[model samples]
Target: MSDLPLRSQLAVALGRTAAKMSRLAGKGDGSVIGGRIGLRLDPELLTRLAKDRKLVLVSATNGKTTTTRLITSAMTPLGEVATNAFGANMPTGHVSALASAPSAQYGVLECDEKYVPQVLRETGASLVALMNLSRDQMDRAAEIWQLAGKWRRALAESPGTHVIANCDDPLVTWGASTASGVIWVAAGQHWREDSWCCPECGGPLDRQEGEENSDWACRQCHFRRPTPQWALHGDHVVDPHGRQIPLGGIQLPGRANRSNAAIALAVVAQFGVPPEQALPLLAQVKSVAGRYTTVEHQGRTLRLLLSKNPAGWLEAFDVLQPAPGPVALAVNAQGPDGRDTSWLWDVDYRILRGRPVFVSGERRIDLAARLEAADVQFTVVDDFEQAVMSVPPGHLDVIANYTAFQDIRTRYGRVV
Candidate 1:
């Protein structure tokens, strides 16, 4: 920060002042607006603050926030590290995190898929973790292939960055393949719709589906999944040539998180944090921006979870299966959650089969219709609070998308 021009320092001070006022006013976390104001004044504030810091950038269509949080924790033993706390993945969030903690020696951040290459370049990040790529925010975001192309070009330019990528997802594999040095992790990917065609050639690719050891190949263009040095086996990630390493301390359920843990461990291992040391850091993470956390609200305690797209929903549904009904699925179509709710049709609602589900949110009717088509029994309690209270209770899994999830956290989880 001492290297930054005086005007840049003033801009950051103004932004920090705005952030403090925002918190005082109970508006929300000041990361977004504060960073926006700062960037408007000093366009290069993001890159300026990133200089000389040990940086790690995490990006994915899903699981990025959780994976980034896990990676940040694994890097903690290294000392003071700045991280994005609100799951803000865009440039603004990165600016806020770096500017707010100018003295920090390291920064770990989750970057939006399309913005990953730019963030990597601006931060001159030493390590990048690429998880899986799938359809998300379909109304506004570029196609998955286009994002992959951007990553490929960006990595080609940033020859100094080492990549930690998922080997199971073809798009991620292709994107990370050209990095200077890459550590492959066989982190599992469940959604396959976007990756059926070869990224190299527009022909169909071959896929062998499995929980942890899935394989994919593109015979037309000779593109294939890299053999991973770290692979997921059942509940834990293992090195086939080495000993079994348990995916411990991670409180989040679902194999998806286990896969996330495997990728995080791989990234930190390059920094000299072995599985024994790194795994525990990740295990302490119970939630990423309230994905799997319980909070007392109204008369009952509501266990909260959030999923944005079909791929995310599938994993959240699988994790909450043992939870007692009636399940509260609050969904909305505000800008942050994507305006189009058509993706609701893509989610496997059949998993909610026998359980009683209560739909709430601005787009509750849209979700109800999708559930009806699948013959999943559900009741709509128009009031989100009433819906959560209506759950039959041994425990309840209350899942929401972006905006609605934040609303729940603000109204119910915190200040209730």
Candidate 2:
């Protein structure tokens, strides 16, 4: 705890020791040492030192990592931006990011939804980006209403802060309604339209009729999904700068990425970067470590999609190509990735469309049972290597949960 300035050096030493111990004991997940070090450190010291630095905090049910990375890429041309790009979006992770960064002018962090309020209070972020909220980690995250209550209080306390919000989500729209100022980002019909029911009234949300792009309105009351101050229409971004940046050639797939790109553009737009300048920077960005990242293994290409909840899983399934070959799913019931495996039932597994799936992980049997109940045919393999090897030497798509994502990437000997 006393070793504040030497934290990075100590982390490196402890990481090496943990790696050696794991190798000796033939164990994985070298988290024991990291956990011990994390418990011993003082978060106050990290926060006090970071007060002079500019901070950008991004929080949501999904798209945090991808959006954080994209914002960081755009902000890099302006100044140094520190971030936790490895999915460690916790309090301790923020401390580690501060310890590891090289005197940055700005800090960009992807915060967990549950921890965002605490993080915002501790870090005093100048700019905060709140993406859509949805049902995620229900067993651990309590109810969606409870989470929304926390966010509402958090935003209310954070006055005069530049807020970037997604107006498409009902809960987020309500939370940001009282914000001092908000830059709203909306998507076309490509955005997930599954959870559009009004959070307050339980009435059906209305969408624009006959329009290719959809906008939401409450059928029962005046609570409506506010028109985005900045919108992404197809590849063009109508920016606050009055510049329409053409951003058609994004490498990442799905409509969700467009929403993420819009949020990233909004964040950078606050820093006085023109949309035209930032869109080109965002266009050249690649996927983050685990979210839809592709890697090569043994002469075959494997695309890895990290799906932690039903909404994220559904979005990934939307972008998945239904090929005649094989598709693999890795499920886990480990800590930090939720212990209850019932969320598998909530996922629209019917999207598999009779295609064969190879399932593996700690919760492999549970996932297999869910698939069977859904009348989906799947081959269950407890061994990770067996599952990967079972894929017929072609383009393989791997959809995995938080814990299983590390296993699949490690097995393929690829950095995600």
For residue 185, model 1's alpha carbon misses the true position, in angstroms, by: 0.6
Tens-place lDDT per residue, model 1, 27-60, is 8788888888888999888889899888889999
Tens-digit lDDT track of model 2 for 1-416: 23345764565446446545865786643334443464365335446546777888898888898999889888877877888776668776676566556477789988888887888788778888988777677767757666776877887888856688877666777766666778877643333443567767778887776542457788998888777777777766677655676668677787778878888888987887767677778877767885677777665678898888887887788678665556789888888788988878877687675676898888999998888888888898878667667766668888999879887777675454
Steric collisions counted per model: 2, 1
For candidate 2, list the clashing residue pairs, or say none: 289-416
Off by over 4 Å in 2: 1-43, 188-197, 201-204, 208-213, 241-243
Identify the leading candidate in terms of TM-score.
1
CA RMSD (A), model 1: 1.7
After best superposition, candidate 1 residue 286: deviation in angstroms?
1.5
Model 2: how far residue 179 lies from native, Å:
1.8
